[model samples]
Target: MSTEGRSAEPVSATSALESAGFVRLVARADGDGLAASGLIASALAELETPFQVTVGRTIAERSARVDPPTNEDDRTIVVGAADAAADTDDVIRLPATDRPATLEAVDLVREIGGTPDPVLALAGVVAGGSEPGAGESEWLLETAIERGLLEQRPGVAVPTSDPIDGVAHSTRLRAPWSGDLDATREALSDAVDGDSDALDADDHRAIGSLVALDAVGADEATDATAESIGRLLRPYATPDHAFATLGGFADVLEALARTEPGTGTALAMGHDVRETALEAWREHGRRAHAALSSASTGRYDGLFVVDVDDGPVETIATIVAASRSPEPVVLAIGHAEAALATREADSLGATVDGVARELAGAEPETEPAFEDGSEIGVEYDVGHRRSYLRYDPDLDNSTIIAAVREFR
Candidate 1:
């Protein structure tokens, strides 16, 4: 197969696989990337096609893991990493956008004359935090419900199977009862009856009222409190899988990817690693809750910075951005890596990726991590709403802080 002009035109995923001598699949380690990889891998198995899937967070890291195709017939499909298109022969380039990569993978599977798995797609939707009642997310959600891959019901949006555990681990709702098992159970006593598998509408309403009351007592901003309550009351998408709900599965994927990329990839590739994933999720929630509780926070002109000693930076950053802070952008920084997240339904008049690039450019030693395997660099996520920066001795936290202040 001639490789010239492949990047300029749109090539069907099916055509690339059929023509390639060997197929190398590179995916990011995040939830959307994992779901996309899993979806495509299943399709390849159905077609009896041999392939390899390499998962990593940054495009540079994932691309570096693959050797250049030895033969012209060999092709590589890069999923959830649009920037990788320039690196080599990308059979498919799904850019990071509001639309999750798993949806794009579903379309590709359909093009390949295979049925897309709705369960994997549902995981991706929840992981991507797709807006409900709008656009493709709504369509995919309806399809999942119709296919029985997901059951829609009125309930609290917490991901855990147990209501008490769910309330305790909830990052969106920061009540006095949060992170305290006894407090959480006491808070839910009136709303819950027996050990129910799921929460009913009345239970949800009661819990929402309590959370609202807590917010009011704490003197939270009216708009921020309302958003928190809305998120808490969103309808639950329960899945008939190892995990209880779609959000729970998404959390597992994220936790595993941050801590152990290989384990996350295994779980996403239809492996029976539910127990392992759940353990990781539990540990992750515990650490995140502790980090949030003890975080030493600083305020920048356009950023809310949370100093974390140890924890999942991305998860912490996302939580702070979505609920804990009113700033348009939030940064959670640790010793090794830092993650920057933008608030939902808001923007900083620029993409986080652009901001990261600018920051990298500000320092001569710092470079864009996705472009090369630099020890100190920045990587923007798929949605352009968040970015991660790998810290180096030269590019320390102080340097990043100063650069960000200058940029802002």
Candidate 2:
């Protein structure tokens, strides 16, 4: 096995990866994540462009079973770079509820001489990849529909939760055009601090249309459903962060289930499955909380904050933008903004004007809210900060669905 601190040329998959728009990272099965990361860092200095790697497989198989008994050997070879460093430390934390841009992973790959092709799509389906018996396609349909990134249609899901909307089709995860991780990250962050006035108008409009959908359809979904929708559009959302955002919703929903027995029954799942979802949500909460604590202690590489202001369109836009710093940015805000972020996104205008307009809805005066609540905006809404989102909204739910379908 190649020893750590030694340089090695990239593997032979370079050509194949070029076609797939992915870079291959190769790590020794015995390496630790830090060591692997160190080596990849060196390799990145020698590559053409940035890249991301998959560490070759899910986390479970990487740390154990790959040693002698598994026949693969115990090297911590991250499949990211053909020959970069890898180990337990570089884990893509169990994502809260959304998919990652593959930028960070790709950066590691590129560091090890792999090309970085940012993956596009929300990651709910891929997150399930690690779970046995999890249906990737289902997550794709469910989360995407929930987010309004995909329109509920015939094959995709129960249209409108009414079963009568007939057909469903979602926006594909892969953008018709290439999506840049940096650009996406920037836009997402911008949304966090956005003044609402400056947001690409499309973003605002898109958001507006979505919340309007929820308000319009609020009568259709059970109270739980409407609340569920409200829980998602947090002021601090990015595509990948939805995972954490959902955890809170899941928690509230769970509490709701305990209070309303019929709600859980309505899902029509076995007890074991319910247990599993709960188990996952618990883990999600724990992980997010842990991340938050780390950020609080200044122990991480990103900016993590729970205080986000919602007001003058410009103020909100500014806050969202600031949250996108590469440093981890954890945010907290209201369900109004959260739901608005994920719901009816497709129906909202996909232009700058549309996006900016949506920010206006956060105004207490403009939309529905509890009494005594600020009508135009909520200052430092804690509900928006989620350890998982860190304000990077580039996830394409459709892309996640596509990958899940491919894997399935």
Candidate 3:
């Protein structure tokens, strides 16, 4: 695997500020946060980018108060004190007086890289044909982990959760996605009813995610149905586990959405899934973007953030598609890295890029449609940071659907 670092010429703190699009300062209503905010504001002012500090109880609350940047000269940075980082989206701690947090913000957006073709690199790793250097491997692995396809163990990698065990009445451990949804659903229902309380954490997480997936994929599902499944999960799952499980289920919906047109409208699964996931995030008192940023199990390469500000939807789509879907696609929107990265599907990334181009070129549609019988057509929403696609089983979108059906 290629171990090349970003080839783009890195910019300096000054340039980063001049081009700053939005700046948000998030601090706790405490002394430390106030001090950090004062320091950060001074630092940004030196760089000619004025920063205003605000004290809030939570990042979501602060982010809600922040207006979008007015122009290219404007930017937003959230400086969370001791524990303020938990709620804020783009956050930094006061590292040292000599090395203020504001400078870190500059560095985040300044050092742009020529991210390797993540698709190709991931393909190589999956094929076992090439070994990526430490840096590349970290990116690929982290990307995969982010997608919920892999989890980091003490010294090895394992599937994030266990597979479906007994479909009906048997007792066996298998991938949850292994069999037909009917059998899997029945098995989960029985298990939960029988004695979910007796199951171990691993079993609970595995079953919970799969059950959630079944809820989303079912022909007839409602808000109540979704909530019930969530309640079943709540008794045994943490916010992170809930997030991961919903993400795993999202992968199922993404696959169905691609192969089955009109599915989005028929089940309105996209809206439901998105709402449910967001609900989970809120119930746990976590901001979706902040939670996603910290969700990485391992972080070797450091963090990167970008301001997409009025960027093309196709560009955003390319970035989202770069993430292996079916898992909840938690994009730190405007937080740019490699636009096309994956684990097993090297070509999937490239294919998504092509699909993104088609999406960008076509008239934006809120409704879904079969696009040239390939993938479903849907529009990308920047603020929502999501794309909703419909699945029409009647449509003969097999050619393109076949291309991505094997991704999982």
Candidate 4:
């Protein structure tokens, strides 16, 4: 009942060890300790012959001990896991489940065993998962050819029927392009209609991914579907979410632009969606720049001002407002606004909104609050029970805020 290194595959733990020539067990303490340990202990229990189980804490330590020539027992071949180290001629390396070492480990194992069958070794490494480190075109081709999974050509390896169909089906499933566009639009819209702020990166990406999937179907309704899908995606297109990593949505937009420029325009939400997506890519740069600029000023990096009016900001504001007393209202302001607001908030008792130019300033209950900026507001019940009056863009500012104050 050892939990260590147990493979889900039906093969007995001793069988896996015997296949690898009972070479040293190489596993990382952090990476594959549990799984590797299970397999090692299982082999020890099943084998009639005696072999010592040596645990290498680090990759360097493991590499130093795994050489067959230096080992005191010629009969004992070490089996171990390592993050990374020089490969030995006699050692068989199993990739750690988490953060496994380089793909070179596969070649290293094959090299030691004097067999070019990477599929067998990699199957043992990945267990049930797809072969590791084969996502790239070149790597996939090389591995496929080397393992006789693909027909080798001058430039690329030609996948056989199984591989070709597998790739195509997997791609479709990943993007799910066959869904009904109109139905998808309504369902997604309803999901977010209640609270766009509730939508996170994954949600937005799902919307983009739906659009991609719809476009792939290329049905008679595709022209209309493209436009409707774009409209649905409009609100979520911010500098965040990275605009869908694989760019299937962007490709869909480009294809739509050729067929229906109007839909493409709407997809852009009246602005260039590609340009905005590119800017989203630049967000990391902006954050890095902000981090570097603020680093020298002895400023705390943890504090960021989210524009309380922003869709995501509104979700937090709702949570804070509903939260128990002394819970600080969250503001979603821009980096520049955060910098300036932190400076002026103490003096003015408020921060101003960049887009609305409204004051989110605080004042005594007796004093009148600033107008216009009430659209983005905060509330708290501490000390004087000051309420930063505001509106959820979905509702009327006056009506909602007034109803909220009625509770106080």
RMSD of each: 4.6, 21.5, 17.8, 23.2
lDDT of 1 by residue, 193-265 (tens): 6766666667667765766676445542335556655655645466667776666677677677777777877
- What lDDT is obtained when candidate 4 is compared to the true structure? 0.29
**Best of the two (1, 2) by TM-score:** 1
Task: In angstroms, give how far residue 404 of model 2 lies from its true place.
Answer: 36
* Candidate 4 residue runs with Cα over 4 Å from true position: 1-22, 29-71, 74-102, 116-140, 143-208, 211-408
Q: What is the lDDT of residue 29 in candidate 2?
A: 16
Task: Quote the lDDT for 42 in model 3.
Answer: 45
Superior candidate under lDDT, 1 versus 3: 1
Task: Name the better of 1 and 3 by TM-score.
Answer: 1
lDDT of 4 at 36: 31
Candidate 1 weakest lDDT stretch, 10 residues: 1-10
Per-residue lDDT over 120-147 for candidate 4, one digit per residue giving the tens place of the 0 to 100 score? 2222222211223334224633664464
Error in Å for residue 195 of model 1: 2.3
Instruction: Tell me the whole-model lDDT of each prediction, alpha carbons only.
Output: 0.66, 0.25, 0.32, 0.29
